[model samples]
Target: MMMITTGRMLRCVSLVSMVIFAVLVNECSSQHTVWDPVHASIKNDIAQGVELNAWCKSKNTDFGHHRIAYGDEFVWTFKINFWNTTLYWCKMWWTDVDGKYTEGSYAIYKAERDWDECQNECHYSVRRDGIYQNNYASDVSDLVYPWPK
Candidate 1:
């Protein structure tokens, strides 16, 4: 009778330990699966044709220099999985009809709790006069570059 009771106690202890381990694992794994969507829209208004390029980056990772055309709109979506109080940015550059180049960018610093408040979409309009229609909260004065200049 003593041996049977000892065996039952060990089994119960093992079961409880397994349950605790499972809960810890679940919590850790769920944190990494939390991701938010970011949308970007670029509209080109430069005449005589132009090459529009844009990209997004977080930490040490970056995406691309996606190319679009004059009078065209390009839309992109990104799934951001990590945030260390670092800002995520999307930058744009273009070569205009006269071979002049212009650039602009937008960035957002999103906190974990603000994930649901993330901007569903951001719009940027690239024009020969300069970058226009910026929707970012940051100051974009540095992004303006008149094509003739």
Candidate 2:
């Protein structure tokens, strides 16, 4: 006959509990953790008479070209890649008052760079002078890219 004393039973329980906890911790620390999607928006804050043309893309996605009117915005949502190297960039162009085309390319969402700065939502304001990123902490839009001549 096999017998288990109270102390022996308690030790078995403790060992089983420890193994379960270890498994849970391992799963939680794995690279397959569910990542929440991030939202990025670009608004045409240019002059009322002008329209902004933009084409945005990432390594895995292309948002296509779009013509945005004054005060309108283009928005996209995506999940950060498993390796955390996700990045999105845009090429933009618009006609100036002088009948010249101004163009530029800028990074919109870079996981490592924006993960802390954007806090899951990134906003950009485009103007004749430059493209600016909206800083939530200061309520200011800082220029990130300038219009190319």
Candidate 3:
């Protein structure tokens, strides 16, 4: 058996320790804001503080847990309910990064309801007063742009 040199062993330990330290630092330093803050801001910009509960949680997600996140786990599911009547699947969307605004996913069915009502229930609003800014996208058949492409 070959003898293990003290220096070699120390170097190995140091490398392992450094790796662990780096990992810990990364884990602690990785901070991500939930997509809600961005979405909420959009609604606020348009509606001036009007928002939906789901939207609010999405933008302000603590990722820390408590009432909304609850131990860093998401407590809410993404969905749209019109006065708890119709559950639409398609809606315009924007992101938290640079406020990149965009329409909803055409692949999904968007929920429908008045923007003011959605803001009232969820406590949110958009920048303008129209179908798109009304908390519900007007065009239900399409998400991004109208069809006929």
Candidate 4:
């Protein structure tokens, strides 16, 4: 029969205590660790010679208005907020080939909805019908918003 001596028990308790303390310290420090930045790209997929006007912003940052030519794209990168509440949205408009004006507003990224799906990168293709979205983690694209007729 193996009996634990008082000294042996004390040493084991000390080792366990040290491991718990180390784990706690690591958990606390991770809250302040810098997060990797997320990239967003918006591409124009309208008809040839058509230009898409886009203005995008977050609560604290605004990317000035841009005119994106067909086949061109506008891109930006930003780090997620410490609170994990980061969000970005855009207002877009363009004149169709028939001279009809179309416009829309959309939330391009919401941390709660995109954190798992986007996994750090988001892509948008603005088409004559709507906006299509693709993410870093998947090749599949989905139309998330449509232009207002």
lDDT of 4 at 20: 100
Encode model 3's per-residue lDDT on 78-117: one tens digit a residue: 4333243323222334332345344332222123433322
Regions of model 3 farther than 4 Å from truth: 27-90, 93-126, 129-149
Backbone clash pairs for candidate 4 read none
TM-score of each: 0.46, 0.74, 0.27, 0.75
Cα lDDT for residue 94, candidate 1: 74
Lowest lDDT sum, 10 consecutive residues, model 2, at 27-36
Could you tell me which 10 consecutive residues in candidate 1 have the lowest summed lDDT? 139-148
Clashes of 4: 0
Residue-wise C-alpha lDDT for candidate 2, range 10-100, written one tens digit per residue: 9999999999999899777653332777878999998887899999999989989999999999999889988889999899999866788
- The predicted structure with the larger lDDT, 2 or 4, is 4
Q: Order the candidates by TM-score, highest first — what do you get?
A: 4, 2, 1, 3
The C-alpha stretches of model 2 lying farther than 4 A from their native spots are 1-34
Task: Summarize candidate 4's per-residue lDDT along 4-122 as a digit string, tens digits.
Answer: 99999999999999999998897786533227788889999988989999999999999999999999999999888888898999999999888999998989888778766666677
Q: Once superposed on the true structure, which residue ranges of model 4 sit more than 4 Å away at CA?
A: 1-34
Of 1 and 2, the candidate ranking higher by TM-score: 2
What would you estimate as the lDDT of candidate 1?
A: 0.60
